[model samples]
Target chain A: MDKENRHHLWLTVPALLSIGLLFSAYGLFGWTSFYRATPGGLGVGGDFTFDNYLRIFGSWRELAVIGETLWISFALTMISLVIAVPMALVIARSPSRLVRSILLFTLAVTFLSGGVTRAYAWMVLLGNKGLINLALVHLGVIERPIRLVFNWLGVSISLVHFLLPFTVFTLVGAVKNLPLSVEEAARNLGATRMTTFFRVTLPLLSSGLVVAASLTYSLALSSFLFPLLLGGGRVRMVANHIYERLFVAYDIPFAAATSAVFLVLSFVVILGFAGLERLVRKVVVR
Target chain B: MNRRSLERPYGRLVPLTATLACLFLLLPVVFVVAFSFNDGAYFQWPPRGPTLRWYVNFFESERFMTATEHSLKVALIVTPACLVVGLPTAVAIARGRFAGRDLIATLLLSPLIVPGVVTGVALLALFTAVHGDLGLGRLLIGMFVFGLPFAVRTMVADLLGLDPRLEEAARNLGATRLRTFFLVTLPQLKSSMLAGAVFVFVEAIDNFSISVFLTDERSAVLPVVAYQYIRDFDDPTVAAMATLLIALSCALVFAIERLIGFERMMHINRK
Candidate 1:
């Protein structure tokens, strides 16, 4: 028994040690601000105070920035879902092997290239003297180039391009899980195609949609590279805000506070969505 | 006859629409490939001329070579470390029947769920709190943290699918528990381990967000180097580097596919 206990202890100890090490590392980094606030800045001598939190709330500029960040995140999520859902449905239900293979390859390429490559692609496409502008001029649509990059529109387009593949993949999984027989049965009952889809298929696909939305929203909210490069510092997301705070301002406490807020907000959004999904499921079952 | 003909057209429409969607997705990638060989330095839609100068330039550059080496080094370190920590935890979770199993699983998988940027920010915060600068140690720690959830989840699913009776039979044959684990159980887990390794390798190599937060110039990985060049200069050198990366990723994918049929290898989510 003693030997067995020792063996189990040996097994558990390493895991515990690793976990402790990770947590300790995290705690140490997080508490740096608490130990030493910047000179002429809020000191960390007292117990954990709400000074940083209050300052964020008290300042209108900060509050507006937060609001703008949330707004962009929300918009990106909604727009990506709108584009992704139909694409996912087409891919899932389509019968052509060539089409399926091509779609999969596209998804794989897009995901593999990701933020850096895609942003570069967009730059080439949207630059004043770049492809789209050149094409427009050749066709006599516009005499001069229009400003596309370094703005909200550019940021949104780049973000959607980056996120669309993942959304489609997730929704495709959901759509695939759905038993085709149920939809077919509804159609066989003399219901219209739209009716069958809306009444039967949509309900079943909601869970997947929720999951996709949560993932998409979180991704959009925390996106840094795409917005930073494409937005040209004009459009700031929460992540960009945090990066600027840490690197530029050297304000660790405020950055920590901002990160904390962002974390809590994301956690709340996820939990709320999960709760709503559960409630909806319960209601439907009952 | 009328209904059959009607359905035929509808089926054709589905294929057509799907083909269009695929075209939309592949267009940007196709553009990248075509431009990589363009002789012109500028990013023109139709190539002014075709040449292999950029690719040649990429091969000759010592900076690109160093960046590639650094990326490989980081991935090599991260992949094994992830396996070491991740596999045992997966085994424990699989074998043990415990309360809060779901919660533990979720916690293990949470890093994947969190956005990369948030993970980066969180890690940055954590590092700063510890008075540690972002360097090799920090980068490894970041990779391990980001890579763990994926490794654990994949390995756990693999373990669950495997029959425990094989290990039990080995033990009954007078083998010690450790010996059975090494001789019998470990060998059978090759495919899962391979899948886990490939997943971790791809992730470590491709990871930008956390690495961006953690790396300084001395420790900078390939993706960051590529990012800097693109942002700073918009040089065609960036295009060459991206082409190389795409080729490398495709090569890795093909290699894995050769080992295990592409379709099976492609599906990383065992659950």
Candidate 2:
């Protein structure tokens, strides 16, 4: 065989194998509703039906849970972005070795700690007998400990902490790669520093902003351990809710529908952003 | 040069804010370590007295040991599997110009965009649908799905930076495609492959979402076990476990840096 054919053969085997493995796995997981059982079975043995999708729409509780999950995820993403952007800007522009080292250490810790461990740390801090309560009691901030654990606030705080490093890292890349010569040229032409930043730096950095925001948004949306542990069942993100339906409720059909909704939502958002990016690129070129 | 005069003050302000941001990020992790040493069972700000009981308790506990073992086993298996799939995928994407390349790349990375909970649920469903029940095989498959994309992306970046002419030169010498890849391409790709492997291992070891959905008592991983301890019991044992895992991750990171150099690996990851 020719070299091209030989290479193709080698590539084809693994590529086909991966596709088959992944799709077959998807099939087995009831990813498609081709196989389903009625509501009476204790396990996964059932005939195929669209009952799961119907059940998801029919249940107000499930709908409400999903709505709440989206709200928290979006909120976390927005808040983290608000905090992370300036921080990224600082890290990019800073000249201090001490400052850089500190930032590096923070990234290391954030990346190393798993979602559940971070949640537990927050739980300790926010719980009645936790650190925050102890400080509050000492300071007389309140007569008794405030209820912080197993709440939306706690969940948000932990999720933001978890996602902060990623936001900074992505944004830093965007900001650092930006061409500074133009900004300097604008300054030489008598533009004020503020004007230069708002007019030049921000616009140039917008691509990075979009990338960081979309990434953070998707990450927060899919986060489960934080909401599960920190939210204390008070905060049920879509992912966790789907998990509960599958594991606790054993409602495979409904779980499948929930998964489908998640997949569609993410796909729509991603495609929308991709289109926006294309539009932005065209405008930039023009 | 003109911007320097005006930009100087703003640059000075950056150090202060960056320092503060770093503090905020490190606070929780520092707290975890501090609380682990607190004499009180509950997390107290000022330690009543420092003690090593939690660490000792963690080591003695059968559950923690089993979970640690399980986590290590999964990481060992999952990291290599991810590399096996990811390296080839990277090679194909980075070097080959083919139809549907973008789509294939997207498909490989779809797991990263999908929520971990969803991945876990999807994998659980997929496993049961195919095998009638979940087992180690399913759990490993789920971990592979999650880790593969990251490995592939990192390796692809690494491969893109490589000089393709070197491989072409080897091919000109009448080396077969397989021989060229193994002798000429593989050695050059080692650092990238190692970096990808370490990345996958860390991700796999720390993952709880899939483990939660798929793990049984016999196959329970460390994160799941640590999570259970934290949930059912309020104790420092979880903290002790976290400390161990943190140490393990740091050691791996250090080893990777020693092997490939930190800057090189970071560059690949950033790319």
Candidate 3:
């Protein structure tokens, strides 16, 4: 082999080794699920069977977790779009750089502060005697602290905060990359701001929003801490359930089966969104 | 009259919503910082006067200090490992004249596509099969698996973004392949490498799902320990520790901004 090919061969080794180990681990995890879990629990023993998959799909409990995960991801992604698109517009197109920089800094802090701290922060904020409750009580809006923590309300708010920066980032890119000239032409033809925005701008933004929603949906689906912490054990998502199946229930086959299914579902949904994005981009976005 | 009517549709509404959105982004973070310095030990509605009690208490505590030190050590090690592994992977994908490089790159980054808890479960099962004990070795391996994706993405983008002519000019002048890479290419890539290193370091320290499963009584990282403390206690010490981490992350964001420009740094987050 020549110098270049030799270098290429050598350079590819580390990537292969790194990816190989993970794939094999996942392969092992997937391989083990095909077998029945031992009666002793936490161990897969006995003959191999398709019972795990059948159990996952046939049972209401397992199917509910799957349905809940998808529904929560979808609902939160839509809510995030409502909040994020306006912020993206401000961050990307506003005349003020000071506003942009401050918003960006807030996003960076929110995005990078890690799950434990963010979860803790929300607990402190949304707890019974927390800031919102205090303010509401003082204003006579309520006579008592409503239950927010350890429920859907708490989880949804915190999850939205977690999902916001990502959607904003994606939408910011879309907003900045907009074909402004086309909008300018619409305005020259006496199109009002609202008409120009909804007609000319929204179509162009569809692909970017699809990308943002895909990312947001995937991240929401995998969320571990928010539901675990803020949901107060009541709003358990698939990730939390997977953990419980092993440590609490000692059901290793179930966790493995669920996660294998989780992995495949993520690929299908994310890849489905990927195809939709291309279709949107092809039709009108570009 | 014309301008007022023309803008009446959502003029005031847009700015109001933007302001609320900004506040929402900072709301939880602001609370975390505020309560960290609370003078009291209670979880009451109004925390007492802000004081340095928790911060001092945290610093003086051995368990907290030890966990912090351990996490830092692991992060320090994981950051360099990522550079060593991810750089070559990035280079091969970006500059190599090889086929299936795209496919290889996708597979390398596949870990990010799945929920990390799945990987945590998989790694837990795999490590247990090998040996039923959790130690620094298994913990490091788990952290490294997740950290490598960030490093590869940043470095690959940086390497691809460089002016190809700089390296080509050196080659045309008969600089050896190794020499040309170090002399011409490495200089331009330094800032992004540092940026990627900061990311990997923070990720290693912040990683919880993977570490949550991998840690034992003897091998617990900060997040794992902090989580346990939170579960057991109602004090502000973990809050103090979290404040310190937030400060460190914010500083790194600023530092990275100065290094590679903030927009470029944010691009590392995108596909």
Candidate 4:
């Protein structure tokens, strides 16, 4: 036991170093957010103030961004929940191994592919001159190209696809635990297929949906690449807002202040979801 | 495999939903790959004609190649470093009874919870102040923070599933703890290590949100370069580069599927 304990501490050195590095950086970020941004200056030592925080709250533009971030995250999670159920049922309940593996393979590829590649692919697929529009025009679905890219609709579409793999994987286990007998029983009782799914499967899936929602919400909240590549400065989430503020305007303090707020906001929202998920599980179980 | 799956059949709707989901997943990847081969100098819906010129151009360009090199250098360095730091922590989490193990695990895994850009913003601020303008070294530290959690999570899951009796058996035979780990335990961890290595390597190379803020021209990774390319030019060179990544990621999915079973591999991230 003593030897084992020694090995344990020895093993944590690298983790300790990692934490030490990150926290010190985080400490610096928080510390820097307080300093007054000297005009015509790179970082300079000066008296600390709440000016950075005040400035973010002071501006309607920044508050709008924060609101947009929350709205988008919520919408993304709701959309994911709608889609994760059917996909999870397929993955967890498919009779053919080939079909299951193929679906899983598609998901793995989506999950494993680089963010930049995925983002670029969306750009090509959704851009004004891109495939979807071109195909639509050729088929006489529309004369002029629809506004698909550079908006919430395009961002939501890409991000929902981006998020499906994780959300499905989260809910798959729950689907597996559900007995086929229950659905079969409902079908035998003269319930239609759609009725069986809605009345039988979905309520049972409530807890799983909530759990997956928490995961989806968190992933959506951190979404950066899709919004950055596809949003075209129209729908700036908090991360991009911070990026633009820092790089475009060279406002380091404000960026830090925004990040600090984002961090707190994410924690509160995720914690709320966690609490909700637990309550859901308890209610579902009872 | 679930034996029930052998007996149970999904109706038409499930399969239909799943197919559409696959198409939605595959279309972006397909478009990117297809456009890379387009002979047009501009963005054309259909290829003007098929050609290998863009792929050739990507390799010949010093700018893209150097960014690829920097990406490779960062991933190669960060993967092993993640292993060194994360392996011990994973072992502790998997087997140790030490105080503060939970806290350390949470600290390492915090990157999953916190927005990755927070790390980028924080590290950029801190590193800029301390080093002013250093390049890869600063980026390395940033990558380490993000990479450690994944590295730790993979090993922890693998280690938990490992039978603890093997190490005890080695110890009973008078092998030292280090000897047991190197000779018996480490060998068993080979699969997890391989999976983790591939996962971390790809993650480091592809990661942008954190790395973006930390990189200067000298330290920019492939994604940053690709991002810049698309922003500046309407050319298809970035598509070629993206195709290469798509192919590599496809190969990785298949590789993990063959070696570790793709679902098990994904479970690491799910955890």
lDDT tens digits, residues A1-286, model 4?
A: 7666756777788788888988998989888888765566446457878988998889898889998999988988888877777888887777677888988888877777788888888887888888889899999999999999999988998999888888998888788778878888777677777887888888788877887888788889888888998998887889898898787877778888999998999999988988887887787677
Docking model 2 quality class: medium
lDDT of 1 at A221: 75
Better of 3 and 4 by DockQ: 4
- Candidate 1 per-residue lDDT, tens place, B53-121, comes to 888887787777777787788789989988897777776667655455556666566556555765676
* Candidate 2 per-residue C-alpha lDDT over A1-286 given as tens digits, one digit per residue, 9 for 90 to 100: 3445335335534644665666565555554554464466434545667677776779898778777766777788788777777777665655665565456546765676666667778888888888778888899989998888798878877888899888877787777677878888778888877788789877787777778878888888888888888878777888888877776877776676787777777878777767776776566645
For model 4, the superposed segments whose C-alpha errors exceed 4 Å read A179-196, B1-8, B163-191, B266-270
Model 3 TM-score on a 0 to 1 scale: 0.93
TM-score, per-candidate, Cα-based: 0.86, 0.90, 0.93, 0.92
Candidate 2 per-residue lDDT over residues B197-249, each given as its tens digit = 87788778888887887888888888888888877887888887777766665
If ranked by DockQ, best first, what sequence of candidates would result? 4, 3, 2, 1
Task: List, for all models, the DockQ compared with the true complex.
Answer: 0.38, 0.51, 0.54, 0.55
Provide candidate 3's TM-score on chain A.
Answer: 0.94
Cα lDDT of model 1 by residue, A111-226, tens digit: 76645666777877788887778889999999998878898888887788888876876688677677887776776777766676678877877777778887787778778888
The parts of candidate 2 lying over 4 Å away from their true place are: A1-6, A28-49, A90-93, A96-98, A136-144, B1-13, B98-100, B132-135, B165-191, B261-263
> How many residue pairs clash per model?
5, 11, 0, 0
Q: Comparing 2 and 4 by lDDT, which wins?
A: 4
Per-residue lDDT over B167-248 for candidate 4, one digit per residue giving the tens place of the 0 to 100 score: 8999999999789989988887766777778778888989889889989888888988889888888778988998898888
